[model samples]
Target: MNIKFKNFIWGVITLSVISSCDISDNKDVNPADSFLRIYDSHQFDHEIRPVDVTQTADNGYLFLGNYRRDDVDFLGTYISSVDEEGHFIRNTYLRDNNVHPVGKFLVLGGEHYFISMDAVSLQAYLNQVDDSARVVSTIGIGTTYPMYAENDGEDQFVLLSYSSVNRTTVLSLVNADGSITSQSAFGIGAGQEVEEPIIDHFTRTGRELPFFAGRSVDGTYYANGFYNYTLSLLFTDLSDNTPSGVIQGQLDQGGISSLLSLSGDNYAVARFNYGDQYANAIATLNTSGISSSTDIEGNPMLEWAYDEKVKMTTMTLGNADYIIIATTTKNQQIALHFYDNTGAYIAVDYLGFSSPYQLGAIQVTSDNGLAILGSTQVAGKFQRLCLFKKSESELNDLVQ
Candidate 1:
């Protein structure tokens, strides 16, 4: 029996299928202008929603998504490896009825890491794959709240975890041998929990915290209500066993959708309405002093036509100057916008996709291009993976 749920929301059925046309058959056709469509009907039995994609060192692409065999039960997360020509090398599946791998997959060296967080505790696991899609390692970190993982270098990784039980944040450096050297409660805040911590960029001197935007260098943290529209910042000197300061503010009347840092000093936050209409602003902060606050202008970039329910995802590519903002509308259409270092709007591009599809994750590659993963519908089933790339010139043209 097919179970119809809200998760299976269907949109308009329209597919802009681009294909490679044969020059011999049509002399006017340009081979360079050809776009390829690679989809196998037999391989994809049900819906295959792409969660994330990454380019390997060998120039191949790794795609991660969920595979649903039925409307109700047989749902599992899948990872597939495709070559430069989009030829499927191998595919693997992780079947779990309880938790779904909804986040993006991080590929470093030859291993892939993904965060799986559901209603309970957040967990991080390292995935080992053979010639086929076989998971050989599922090493678990027990009860790490708000677990997030990023590649450090080589085969090493850094896992940032927040402990709600202790109200502290822990940074664990993991080696290839699965041994961990941990620094517990590095920041300055006790009785206060740390939210999201990402390795923004590596400096010549050392690694710096790019995720510190809208946060305090003195150990203050800021976040909105999980399901509300309130925004607040709390200060803590968790490094020492001492109490710090707390600052709170309601930056948005609607709801906070996303937050990102510009370089090391400036930051941007997105706010939207509940009805999925367009509305957002970019808030900047200066961290030159011990205590920091939003600029006098409030949100520098405000949009009335921007969809409120549309969640904005951000990524800083190459240098800190180039920031990419990608968002998907309630209609499941994906749009990309680029901003300069000064938080000025630069350019925007639209990736064409049919209905019943939505954008999932965006990642900047080593070459400064983007890897987008999302889901599409095929034969009335709502699970298909799509990947796209835009050159630097194409991105710059959007701003012009």
Candidate 2:
């Protein structure tokens, strides 16, 4: 109810309504129409939860998710700016008067990054915004849990903080006016608590040099079940903290939900799970070190054939070498798996929303198209915001 982006772009000419059932059709009629549901709305009074949607070098569309503010007791996490037809060009709310900002929101370059966590006061903030929403800077980086931020391009940024009280891995480097130019920690075990260290894909193998692929662990493996874990290969030097080489291994069973950095050399691709079943794992390292064994393409049991109750959550690397895997099954359907770059098995698309949709955040759109943010539900009573877009000939026919 406190939405503003110049009053929702001047109230979109008196709120242009278009909700008369077809539910935004085009669920796949081909002709270059690979599953279309362009912009569906559930209004917006309290729930419009989109947690991250980027692409706005003027082509428009920027959204960070969370809503629900009747004075704010809990639901308030947002940063929106839309236009490529999805309308709603301005919306910002990270709340304060007492604090209750959740977490995760990244847009990079044109700026807009977030990392808030205060479930009742665990306290954490590392916000930044600019592109008219203006906040420009804010940092406190302390009590972190779901952390992973990237943009080693020029203005510098790479947060990755996972410290379960000494189970190490800090690596800060954030500048562009937000400060902190070196933080470094990296250890991996003593108290262990690294769970889901994402970033999953970042390129550039020479000029403009950049590199990052993610997956970190040592603890919280299903509360302490599978042990031996390690998946690294971080060669950095986007202009400082020196790490021109690093390659480690030992997963011995499976448990790495995401990591991608293919073609630029030290090969990377991981969306793991052997105990809980999910698959699409591939790892490589140069200067001759780690050689890997877990491609799952030849059907090593489909690496557990999914439905282990939805949770392979994110992985991207496409543009001819393709390798996109986004899972959330158990009938909640959001699957999409295409492989290549040596893993084979190039096509699989499943989008069929319903049953409390849950596929939180995913990006890759410099024309290679794909921008998904999650949270859905309506007839059963309210909960909105589930942005969408997918085209590149429907991700190349779901990986041809």
Pick the lDDT winner: 2
Task: Write the residue-wise lDDT of candidate 1 on 7-72 in tens digits.
Answer: 211224433232222333546643222222333323445566655676666656677666654432
- TM of each candidate vs. truth: 0.61, 0.31
- Superposed by TM-score, candidate 2 places the C-alpha of residue 17 at a distance from the truth, in angstroms, of 5.6
Model 1 local distance difference test score: 0.45
Q: Give the range of the ten consecutive residues with the poorest summed lDDT in model 1.
A: 199-208
Summarize candidate 2's per-residue lDDT along 1-400 as a digit string, tens digits. 1212222222443332221113234445422211222223424455665545666666455666656566634445667665544555556665663233333345456566666545454345567766444456666655443244655555665666444555544556666555666565555533222233221210111111011223233110011111123544334433443344444433323433344544344233443444444344345434223333343222333423342222222334444565666655555556667666676666777665444555656666666667666655655556655555676665765565
TM-score of 2: 0.31
Give candidate 1's error at residue 96 in angstroms: 5.8
Model 1 misplacement above 4 A = 1-46, 68-75, 96-99, 102-104, 107-111, 117-123, 130-136, 144-147, 152-180, 183-256, 273-282, 286-321, 353-356, 366-368
lDDT of 2: 0.46
In order of listing, the candidates' clash counts read 18, 3
